[model samples]
Target: MNKRGQFYLVATVIIVSIIAGLAVISNYSYEKTPSKFYPIEQELRIESAKVMDYGIANGKNTNDLMKNFSRDYSINSDSDSSYFVFGKEDNLTLAGYNELNSTTIQINVGLGEQAMNFTKGQFQAFNFSNTGENIKVIISNVSYDFKLNKGQNFYFVVSKNIDGEKYVATNL
Candidate 1:
Protein backbone atom coordinates (compact mmCIF):
# COMPACT_ATOMS: atom_id res chain seq x y z
CA MET A 1 0.00 0.00 0.00
CA ASN A 2 2.78 2.43 0.92
CA LYS A 3 4.66 1.77 -2.37
CA ARG A 4 1.49 2.35 -4.45
CA GLY A 5 0.76 5.69 -2.73
CA GLN A 6 4.30 6.89 -3.35
CA PHE A 7 4.08 5.92 -6.99
CA TYR A 8 0.81 7.87 -7.49
CA LEU A 9 2.26 10.96 -5.82
CA VAL A 10 5.29 10.85 -8.10
CA ALA A 11 3.11 10.48 -11.16
CA THR A 12 0.94 13.48 -10.17
CA VAL A 13 3.98 15.67 -9.55
CA ILE A 14 5.47 14.81 -12.94
CA ILE A 15 2.21 15.49 -14.75
CA VAL A 16 1.75 18.84 -12.98
CA SER A 17 5.32 19.85 -13.69
CA ILE A 18 4.94 19.00 -17.35
CA ILE A 19 1.74 21.05 -17.63
CA ALA A 20 3.35 24.01 -15.89
CA GLY A 21 6.34 23.82 -18.18
CA LEU A 22 4.12 23.82 -21.23
CA ALA A 23 2.17 26.83 -19.93
CA VAL A 24 5.33 28.82 -19.39
CA ILE A 25 6.62 27.95 -22.84
CA SER A 26 3.35 28.99 -24.43
CA ASN A 27 3.34 32.28 -22.56
CA TYR A 28 6.89 33.01 -23.64
CA SER A 29 6.04 32.27 -27.24
CA TYR A 30 2.98 34.53 -27.09
CA GLU A 31 5.08 37.34 -25.72
CA LYS A 32 7.70 36.92 -28.40
CA THR A 33 5.14 37.11 -31.22
CA PRO A 34 4.13 40.60 -32.24
CA SER A 35 0.46 41.45 -32.19
CA LYS A 36 -1.10 42.74 -35.40
CA PHE A 37 -3.06 45.77 -34.38
CA TYR A 38 -5.12 48.08 -36.53
CA PRO A 39 -3.77 48.50 -40.08
CA ILE A 40 -3.72 52.30 -40.30
CA GLU A 41 -1.53 52.34 -43.38
CA GLN A 42 -3.90 50.09 -45.30
CA GLU A 43 -6.87 52.21 -44.27
CA LEU A 44 -5.20 55.34 -45.53
CA ARG A 45 -4.30 53.68 -48.81
CA ILE A 46 -7.85 52.48 -49.43
CA GLU A 47 -9.30 55.87 -48.62
CA SER A 48 -6.80 57.60 -50.84
CA ALA A 49 -7.72 55.32 -53.72
CA LYS A 50 -11.41 55.93 -53.11
CA VAL A 51 -10.83 59.66 -53.23
CA MET A 52 -9.02 59.35 -56.53
CA ASP A 53 -11.74 57.16 -57.96
CA TYR A 54 -14.40 59.59 -56.82
CA GLY A 55 -12.62 62.49 -58.39
CA ILE A 56 -12.11 60.68 -61.66
CA ALA A 57 -15.68 59.43 -61.89
CA ASN A 58 -17.42 62.70 -60.95
CA GLY A 59 -15.68 64.96 -63.44
CA LYS A 60 -14.78 67.36 -60.62
CA ASN A 61 -12.00 69.78 -61.55
CA THR A 62 -8.56 69.42 -60.09
CA ASN A 63 -8.99 72.04 -57.39
CA ASP A 64 -12.50 71.01 -56.47
CA LEU A 65 -11.60 67.36 -56.51
CA MET A 66 -8.65 67.91 -54.23
CA LYS A 67 -10.65 70.19 -51.98
CA ASN A 68 -13.47 67.70 -51.71
CA PHE A 69 -11.06 64.84 -51.15
CA SER A 70 -9.21 66.62 -48.39
CA ARG A 71 -12.43 67.71 -46.78
CA ASP A 72 -14.00 64.29 -46.94
CA TYR A 73 -10.96 62.39 -45.71
CA SER A 74 -9.39 64.35 -42.92
CA ILE A 75 -5.73 63.35 -42.86
CA ASN A 76 -3.79 65.84 -40.75
CA SER A 77 -0.29 65.59 -42.10
CA ASP A 78 0.96 68.04 -39.47
CA SER A 79 -0.45 66.06 -36.57
CA ASP A 80 0.72 62.76 -38.03
CA SER A 81 4.09 64.32 -38.94
CA SER A 82 4.10 62.36 -42.21
CA TYR A 83 4.93 63.41 -45.74
CA PHE A 84 2.89 62.17 -48.71
CA VAL A 85 4.58 62.24 -52.09
CA PHE A 86 2.34 62.15 -55.17
CA GLY A 87 4.20 61.59 -58.40
CA LYS A 88 2.82 61.51 -61.93
CA GLU A 89 4.66 59.86 -64.81
CA ASP A 90 3.04 57.19 -66.93
CA ASN A 91 1.14 56.55 -63.69
CA LEU A 92 0.36 58.38 -60.46
CA THR A 93 1.89 57.10 -57.24
CA LEU A 94 0.96 58.14 -53.71
CA ALA A 95 3.43 57.10 -51.03
CA GLY A 96 3.38 58.02 -47.35
CA TYR A 97 4.15 56.71 -43.88
CA ASN A 98 2.13 56.85 -40.68
CA GLU A 99 4.10 57.34 -37.50
CA LEU A 100 1.47 55.68 -35.34
CA ASN A 101 1.75 52.24 -36.94
CA SER A 102 5.27 52.59 -38.30
CA THR A 103 3.93 51.44 -41.65
CA THR A 104 4.24 52.87 -45.14
CA ILE A 105 1.94 52.49 -48.13
CA GLN A 106 2.56 53.18 -51.80
CA ILE A 107 -0.48 53.56 -54.01
CA ASN A 108 -0.04 53.74 -57.76
CA VAL A 109 -2.69 55.00 -60.12
CA GLY A 110 -2.10 54.11 -63.73
CA LEU A 111 -3.98 55.14 -66.83
CA GLY A 112 -4.46 53.29 -70.11
CA GLU A 113 -3.20 49.70 -69.91
CA GLN A 114 -1.55 49.56 -66.47
CA ALA A 115 1.35 51.97 -66.88
CA MET A 116 2.64 51.39 -63.31
CA ASN A 117 2.88 47.96 -61.70
CA PHE A 118 4.03 47.12 -58.17
CA THR A 119 6.44 44.16 -58.02
CA LYS A 120 7.59 44.61 -54.47
CA GLY A 121 4.79 43.16 -52.36
CA GLN A 122 1.08 42.34 -52.39
CA PHE A 123 -1.25 45.14 -53.52
CA GLN A 124 -4.85 45.91 -54.40
CA ALA A 125 -5.66 47.50 -57.75
CA PHE A 126 -8.59 49.65 -58.87
CA ASN A 127 -9.43 51.04 -62.29
CA PHE A 128 -11.62 53.99 -63.19
CA SER A 129 -11.81 56.65 -65.87
CA ASN A 130 -13.44 59.85 -67.09
CA THR A 131 -13.85 61.56 -70.46
CA GLY A 132 -11.69 64.67 -70.29
CA GLU A 133 -8.17 66.00 -70.60
CA ASN A 134 -5.34 65.42 -68.17
CA ILE A 135 -5.61 67.55 -65.04
CA LYS A 136 -3.26 68.21 -62.15
CA VAL A 137 -4.51 68.08 -58.58
CA ILE A 138 -2.68 68.92 -55.38
CA ILE A 139 -3.49 67.03 -52.21
CA SER A 140 -1.69 67.54 -48.91
CA ASN A 141 1.09 69.46 -50.62
CA VAL A 142 1.50 66.69 -53.22
CA SER A 143 0.66 67.26 -56.85
CA TYR A 144 -0.84 64.46 -59.00
CA ASP A 145 -1.42 64.91 -62.70
CA PHE A 146 -4.13 62.51 -63.79
CA LYS A 147 -4.49 61.87 -67.48
CA LEU A 148 -8.25 61.72 -67.59
CA ASN A 149 -9.29 61.20 -71.20
CA LYS A 150 -12.25 59.64 -72.93
CA GLY A 151 -12.38 55.87 -72.34
CA GLN A 152 -9.10 55.98 -70.41
CA ASN A 153 -8.41 53.15 -67.97
CA PHE A 154 -7.13 54.34 -64.60
CA TYR A 155 -5.50 51.67 -62.44
CA PHE A 156 -5.04 52.19 -58.70
CA VAL A 157 -2.75 49.88 -56.76
CA VAL A 158 -2.41 49.99 -52.97
CA SER A 159 0.59 48.25 -51.39
CA LYS A 160 1.54 48.24 -47.72
CA ASN A 161 4.85 47.47 -46.04
CA ILE A 162 4.85 46.96 -42.27
CA ASP A 163 8.06 45.77 -40.63
CA GLY A 164 8.63 43.37 -43.53
CA GLU A 165 5.11 42.05 -43.11
CA LYS A 166 3.04 41.80 -46.27
CA TYR A 167 -0.76 41.93 -46.60
CA VAL A 168 -3.30 42.53 -49.36
CA ALA A 169 -6.15 45.02 -49.19
CA THR A 170 -9.38 43.08 -49.57
CA ASN A 171 -11.43 46.09 -50.63
CA LEU A 172 -9.93 47.66 -53.73
Candidate 2:
Protein backbone atom coordinates (compact mmCIF):
# COMPACT_ATOMS: atom_id res chain seq x y z
CA MET A 1 0.00 0.00 0.00
CA ASN A 2 1.17 3.58 -0.60
CA LYS A 3 2.33 5.71 2.34
CA ARG A 4 -0.47 8.30 1.80
CA GLY A 5 -3.19 5.66 1.80
CA GLN A 6 -1.81 4.05 4.97
CA PHE A 7 -1.65 7.44 6.77
CA TYR A 8 -5.26 8.27 5.92
CA LEU A 9 -6.49 4.91 7.18
CA VAL A 10 -4.60 5.31 10.48
CA ALA A 11 -6.03 8.86 10.94
CA THR A 12 -9.59 7.61 10.42
CA VAL A 13 -9.14 4.85 13.00
CA ILE A 14 -7.72 7.32 15.53
CA ILE A 15 -10.63 9.73 14.98
CA VAL A 16 -13.19 6.95 15.49
CA SER A 17 -11.49 5.84 18.67
CA ILE A 18 -11.54 9.37 20.06
CA ILE A 19 -15.24 9.76 19.33
CA ALA A 20 -16.04 6.43 20.98
CA GLY A 21 -14.05 7.33 24.06
CA LEU A 22 -15.85 10.66 24.39
CA ALA A 23 -19.24 9.00 24.09
CA VAL A 24 -18.41 6.47 26.78
CA ILE A 25 -17.06 9.13 29.11
CA SER A 26 -20.14 11.29 28.72
CA ASN A 27 -22.47 8.44 29.59
CA TYR A 28 -20.40 7.56 32.64
CA SER A 29 -20.35 11.17 33.86
CA TYR A 30 -23.70 10.92 35.56
CA GLU A 31 -25.52 7.76 36.55
CA LYS A 32 -28.99 7.59 38.06
CA THR A 33 -30.22 4.55 39.96
CA PRO A 34 -33.40 3.97 41.91
CA SER A 35 -31.53 2.07 44.61
CA LYS A 36 -28.67 4.45 45.07
CA PHE A 37 -28.25 3.67 48.78
CA TYR A 38 -29.60 0.16 48.94
CA PRO A 39 -26.74 -1.45 50.79
CA ILE A 40 -26.42 1.27 53.36
CA GLU A 41 -30.16 1.33 53.85
CA GLN A 42 -30.35 -2.37 54.46
CA GLU A 43 -27.68 -2.04 57.06
CA LEU A 44 -29.57 0.76 58.71
CA ARG A 45 -32.68 -1.39 58.97
CA ILE A 46 -30.85 -4.37 60.46
CA GLU A 47 -28.98 -2.31 63.00
CA SER A 48 -32.09 -0.44 64.06
CA ALA A 49 -33.98 -3.66 64.57
CA LYS A 50 -31.23 -5.01 66.76
CA VAL A 51 -31.26 -1.85 68.80
CA MET A 52 -34.99 -2.20 69.27
CA ASP A 53 -34.64 -5.78 70.38
CA TYR A 54 -32.07 -4.88 73.00
CA GLY A 55 -34.18 -2.01 74.22
CA ILE A 56 -37.17 -4.30 74.54
CA ALA A 57 -35.26 -6.88 76.52
CA ASN A 58 -34.05 -4.22 78.90
CA GLY A 59 -37.38 -2.35 79.04
CA LYS A 60 -35.82 0.84 77.76
CA ASN A 61 -37.82 3.70 76.30
CA THR A 62 -37.98 4.50 72.61
CA ASN A 63 -36.76 8.06 73.18
CA ASP A 64 -33.36 6.90 74.37
CA LEU A 65 -33.04 4.40 71.60
CA MET A 66 -34.03 6.94 68.97
CA LYS A 67 -31.53 9.51 70.16
CA ASN A 68 -28.58 7.14 70.22
CA PHE A 69 -29.46 5.42 66.94
CA SER A 70 -29.89 8.70 65.13
CA ARG A 71 -26.57 10.09 66.28
CA ASP A 72 -24.59 6.91 65.72
CA TYR A 73 -26.10 6.18 62.34
CA SER A 74 -25.37 9.68 61.10
CA ILE A 75 -21.73 9.41 62.08
CA ASN A 76 -21.07 5.83 61.00
CA SER A 77 -22.73 6.08 57.60
CA ASP A 78 -21.00 9.35 56.67
CA SER A 79 -23.76 9.92 54.19
CA ASP A 80 -25.67 12.99 53.18
CA SER A 81 -28.31 14.47 55.44
CA SER A 82 -31.29 12.25 56.26
CA TYR A 83 -34.35 12.56 58.45
CA PHE A 84 -35.70 9.81 60.69
CA VAL A 85 -39.32 8.96 61.57
CA PHE A 86 -39.75 6.28 64.23
CA GLY A 87 -41.50 5.67 67.51
CA LYS A 88 -43.67 3.35 69.50
CA GLU A 89 -46.69 3.50 71.82
CA ASP A 90 -48.29 6.94 71.58
CA ASN A 91 -45.10 8.68 70.53
CA LEU A 92 -43.88 9.29 67.01
CA THR A 93 -40.65 11.12 66.41
CA LEU A 94 -39.52 12.76 63.17
CA ALA A 95 -36.08 14.22 63.29
CA GLY A 96 -33.24 15.51 61.07
CA TYR A 97 -33.38 16.76 57.46
CA ASN A 98 -32.50 15.21 54.14
CA GLU A 99 -30.72 17.22 51.51
CA LEU A 100 -32.41 17.58 48.14
CA ASN A 101 -30.87 17.37 44.71
CA SER A 102 -32.92 20.23 43.32
CA THR A 103 -35.08 23.05 44.55
CA THR A 104 -38.21 21.82 42.74
CA ILE A 105 -38.53 18.35 44.25
CA GLN A 106 -41.56 18.08 46.57
CA ILE A 107 -41.25 16.75 50.14
CA ASN A 108 -44.03 15.73 52.45
CA VAL A 109 -44.09 14.29 56.00
CA GLY A 110 -47.23 13.02 57.65
CA LEU A 111 -48.27 11.51 60.97
CA GLY A 112 -51.86 10.38 61.30
CA GLU A 113 -54.21 12.91 59.67
CA GLN A 114 -51.70 15.73 59.88
CA ALA A 115 -49.31 16.19 57.02
CA MET A 116 -46.64 18.82 56.45
CA ASN A 117 -45.26 19.80 53.08
CA PHE A 118 -41.90 21.41 52.62
CA THR A 119 -39.98 22.63 49.65
CA LYS A 120 -36.68 21.23 48.55
CA GLY A 121 -33.95 21.81 51.14
CA GLN A 122 -36.61 23.20 53.47
CA PHE A 123 -37.18 20.19 55.65
CA GLN A 124 -37.05 20.49 59.43
CA ALA A 125 -37.15 17.93 62.19
CA PHE A 126 -40.53 17.69 63.92
CA ASN A 127 -42.13 15.40 66.47
CA PHE A 128 -45.65 14.59 67.62
CA SER A 129 -47.72 11.96 69.39
CA ASN A 130 -50.44 9.73 68.03
CA THR A 131 -53.87 8.93 69.43
CA GLY A 132 -54.00 5.21 68.75
CA GLU A 133 -54.42 5.91 65.07
CA ASN A 134 -52.44 5.00 62.02
CA ILE A 135 -49.27 6.93 61.17
CA LYS A 136 -48.79 8.13 57.64
CA VAL A 137 -45.75 9.53 55.88
CA ILE A 138 -45.68 10.96 52.38
CA ILE A 139 -42.39 11.90 50.76
CA SER A 140 -41.87 13.02 47.19
CA ASN A 141 -45.23 11.61 46.00
CA VAL A 142 -44.61 8.30 47.80
CA SER A 143 -46.80 7.36 50.72
CA TYR A 144 -46.02 5.08 53.70
CA ASP A 145 -48.55 4.09 56.32
CA PHE A 146 -48.10 2.15 59.53
CA LYS A 147 -50.05 1.08 62.58
CA LEU A 148 -48.35 1.20 65.93
CA ASN A 149 -48.90 -1.38 68.63
CA LYS A 150 -48.01 -1.88 72.30
CA GLY A 151 -44.79 -3.68 71.52
CA GLN A 152 -41.52 -1.97 70.77
CA ASN A 153 -42.43 -0.96 67.24
CA PHE A 154 -40.51 1.56 65.19
CA TYR A 155 -40.23 2.76 61.61
CA PHE A 156 -37.17 4.29 60.01
CA VAL A 157 -36.90 6.03 56.66
CA VAL A 158 -33.88 7.22 54.79
CA SER A 159 -34.02 9.12 51.53
CA LYS A 160 -31.31 10.16 49.14
CA ASN A 161 -31.75 12.45 46.18
CA ILE A 162 -30.41 10.93 42.99
CA ASP A 163 -30.49 12.99 39.81
CA GLY A 164 -33.38 15.13 41.07
CA GLU A 165 -35.43 12.13 42.15
CA LYS A 166 -36.07 10.81 45.65
CA TYR A 167 -34.82 7.30 46.39
CA VAL A 168 -35.88 5.93 49.77
CA ALA A 169 -34.71 3.04 51.95
CA THR A 170 -36.89 2.15 54.85
CA ASN A 171 -37.47 -0.41 57.61
CA LEU A 172 -41.23 -0.79 57.53
Report the number of the highest-lDDT candidate. 2
What is the C-alpha lDDT profile of model 2 across 1-38, one tens digit per residue?
69999999999999999999999988886565765488
TM-score of each: 0.34, 0.58
Candidate 1 residue 123 Cα shift, in angstroms, is 27
User: For each candidate, what is the lDDT?
Assistant: 0.40, 0.62
Q: Report how far off residue 21 is in candidate 2 (Å).
A: 14
RMSD value for candidate 1: 10.6
Poorest 10 consecutive residues of model 2 by lDDT?
Answer: 103-112
The digit string of per-residue lDDT tens for model 1 on 1-172 reads: 9999999999999999999999998888432322332354566566656666776688754334434443333243222223232223333233332333433332333333223222222221222333224544332234445554433123222223445753322222
